[model samples]
Target: MKKYSYQKCTAIVLAFIMFFSLFAGVNQAKAEAGLNVNADGAILVDGETGKVLYEKNADSPLGIASMTKMMSEYLLLDAVKHGKVKWNQEYSVSELVYKISQPTSLSNVPLRRDGKYNVRELYEAMAIYSANGATIALAEVIAGSETNFVKMMNEKAKKLGLKNTKFVNSTGLNNKDYHGEQPQGTGADEENVMSPRDVATLAFHLINEYPDVLKTASTPMKVFREGTTDRIVMKNWNWMLPSLVYGYKGMDGLKTGTTDFAGYCFTGTATRDGKRFITVVQNAKDSSGKNDGYKARFGETKKMLDYAFSNYTKEELVAKHYQVKGHKTIPVIKGKEDKVKIYTKSAINMVIPNNEKDNYKPVLVLDKKKVNKNGEVTAPIKKGEKLGYLTIEPKNGDKVSFLTEEGQKKVQVDIIAVQDVEKANWFVLMMRSIGNFFGDVGHGISSTVKGWF
Candidate 1:
C-alpha cells in the first residue's frame, strides 16, 4: 500500500507540472503577441474616432523622409476641392523641379524642364512612387513657387493643431546644400521634422479630406502618363497593401519614407468589417541603408496591425432605446403622465480590449443645469429631444480610457428623451391646487398651536 501511494503521488505531481507549463506558455504568447517595435517612434489609432490604440515614442520629433509629401498632397487636394485646380489641368515643370529630379538615387519620375503633366498624373506619381520632382512641380503650380508652397504647408500643419511639425521643402529629401527659395520658418537642416503622432494626424486629415488619394496609394503599379507605350511604370512603395507577403486582409494605402538620417518610416492603414485603423512607424532602424533595415518599418507596422485586429473587438456598449440603470424614469412637471422614459439617442459602440470587455462601466448623468435644473422636465416634452448626455467611463483600474491620436480623451455620447409628455388637463390642475391650499392651511394652524404652547 505504501509503494502504491508513492507512485500515485509522483504521478499527480507530474500532471500538475504539465498543466502549469501549458498555462505559462499560453500566457507568454499572449503577452508577446503585441508589437515590440524597433523604431524611434510609432503609433496605432482608430481611423474613425482618432483614438490611440498603441504608441511608443509617439511624441518624439524626428526627421520625416518622404512623408512630407502628405502635406503637399493635402494642399494640392484641398486646392482641387476648392476649385483652384482641376484634375485635368496641366502644369509645366520648372527648371528648379528639373534640378531636384536629377537625383538618381532618390525616387523620381524624371520630370524635365519642358515636361508638362496633368495634376492627376503628378499626384499619383508623388503619392505612390514618392516622386520628389512631381511633388515640386505640383507645389509650384498651386502656390507659384516651392518656397511659398512650404509656407502653405506649415500653415496647414498649424491649423491641424500639430505642435511638433515643420516643413522646409515639399519633398522630404535633405536639402541643406540646395540653396533655392526657402520657406519662412525653415532652419538650415532643411529636412521636415514631425513626430509619429503628427504624421498619423496628417494621414488622418489627408484621408478624411480626400479619400480618393487611397486609390492612388493602393495601386501596385501604373503607367505614368498612360497613353504612350514608352511611359514609365510607377510602383507603390508601401508593401503592406495587397499582393505583398506582409499584406494584411484589409491593408490599403498611406505612405513610406526612408533616408540615411531619417531611417525607414511608413504610415499604414487598413479596414476590416467597416472598421479602419491607421499605424505610423517612424525611424525604424539606424542602418536603413541596408535591405534588412529598410524592411523593418513594414515588419513593425504589420505587427501593430495584427495585434490590434486580433486582440481588440468593437462591441455595442449601449443599444438604442435601452433604459439606463439606476434612474428609470424622470419626473414630468404639470403633465398628464407622471413621468417619461429616457434612453440613448443612438447605439453606443466601443472598441475594447479582449481582456477588458466586462471591466468598463457606463455612468449616466443627466444635465440638470441645462434642461432640468430643478430636477424636472416641463410638460409638452417632445419625443427624441435631447435631455442630457451620458458619460461612459472605465471602472477603476480598467485600461479602457486610452489616449486619442489627437491627444485628448474620448468624448462620451449624449442621451435623449424617448417619449413625449403632454400637459395636464384643467381638471387635474384644479384638483392639485385645491389639495395644496388645504395642506398650507393645516401647516399654518399647526405652527400657531406650537407658538401658543
Candidate 2:
C-alpha cells in the first residue's frame, strides 16, 4: 500500500507539470499573434495614388526626431530648383553650429570652427548620416538663420497641407540638446512633432515634386569631404536599404529617426516588379514594449510591405468610354440629332485589393451650366467636350479615406460627349414647329366631336 501511494503521488506531480507547460505554450502563441506592427503609430500607402491601405493611430501627433529633416530636404530642393541657392554655394560655420557639431554623442560629420562647406556636401551629410551640424549649416545658408529657417519649415508644412505637423527647429533634436541656443521662437524643451500620416504626405510630395532627391537618398554610404583629412564615411541610418545589413530588395531612399521620446521610427519606400509602396512605423517596440533598436522599426516596415505587395494589384476600375446606365445619353435642343451619347474621358486605374475587384461603382455628375432644366444642351456641341466628371465609389457603401484631403476627392474621371451635335437649319425648325401646332389643334377638335356624340 505504501509503495502504491508513493507511485501515485509521482504520477500526479508529472501530470501537473505537463498541464502548466501546455498552458504557458498557448499564452506565448497568443502574444506572438497579437499585432505585427508593434508600434504606437503606423501606416501603409500606395506610392502612386496616396491611398491609405492601412493605418493604426496614424493621425496621432508624436515626436519625429531626425525625420524632421525631410521637410528641410524639401525646402532645400525647392531652393535649388528655383536657382535661389546654388549647389556649390559655400556656407561659413557659425558659433552656434560649431558648438552643435562638437558633441560626440550626436550623429554628425565634425566641422572646423572656420570650415566653409558647400551646399551639396552638407546636404549629403544630412541625408545619409542624419548629421545635426550639417543640417544646421544648410538651414542657415537657406534662410540666413536657424530661427528664420524654422519659420520657413512651418510655413512650408502648412502650404503642403500637413495638418498635424509642427517644426520647432531645423534638426529634430530636443531643443535642450542645443545647450541654451535653441531656435529663438521655440521653448528650450520643445521638439519637432508630426503624425505618421503627415510624414507620409510630406514624403509623397517630396518624391513627386523633387524625384531627384531619391538619387542621393538611395546612396548607402558616402564620404563627406572625401579625399581630405575631414572626410568621414557617412552611412545611411535606413537599414532597409538594399545595400545594408537588413537589406530588403527594391528598398531605396527614405529617412529614419529615434529618440527617448519618439523611440524608433522609419519611413521606407520600396518597389518590386513595378509596384511601389510607402510605409511609416513610429515608436516601434518588441512584444514586451521595449525598444529593440533598429531591428524593430525595419521589422515592422517589412510586415507592412509584405502585406501591401502580396494583397494589392493595379486594376483598371473603370474603362475608357464607359457610360452610366441611366445617364448614357442626354437630349439636345435644335440639333440635327435629338440626343448625344456621353462617356468617360479616360480609364480609371487604381491599386485595389484582390478580393474587392468588383466592389466599385461609378457615380456621374453633370456640369450644371452645360445642361438646362430639361437636361438638354443646345446645338453645336463638339465631340469630346467636357460635360462633367464621373467618380468611383465602393459598392458595399464603405467610406474610403486617403492620405490627404485632396486625395479623398481625386477618384474621378471627366465625362465627355461622344460626338458632335450640329445646330438644325432654321427652315427645318420652323416647319417642325408649324406641324406640331396643327397636330395639337386637330387633336382638340377630335376631342370636342367625341364629347358631342
- The most accurate candidate by TM-score is 2
lDDT of 2 by residue, 1-453 (tens): 999999999999999999999999999897455446889999889887789888888889988899999999999999999999999999889998899998869988899999899999999999899999999999999999999999999999999888899999998999999988999978999989999999999998888788887888899999888899988988899888888989998988689988888889999999887778989888988768888879889889988898888888988888999999999999998899999999999988878887787899988988899989889988889999999889888999887777775565557789999999999999988987898899999999999999998
Worst lDDT window (10 residues) for model 2?
Answer: 402-411
Model 2 ranges with Cα > 4 A deviation: 1-36, 405-410, 425-453
Over 244-305, each residue of candidate 1 has an lDDT whose tens digit, in order, gives 65666788879898887788888899988767789998788533434355468887887888
Evaluate all candidate structures by whole-model CA lDDT and list the values in order: 0.80, 0.89
Pairs in clash, predicted candidate 1 = none
Which whole-number lDDT from 0 to 100 does residue 412 have in model 2? 79
TM-score of each: 0.84, 0.87
lDDT of 1: 0.80
User: How many clashes does each candidate structure show, in the order listed?
Assistant: 0, 0
The RMSD of every model to the true structure, in order and in angstroms, is 5.4, 9.9
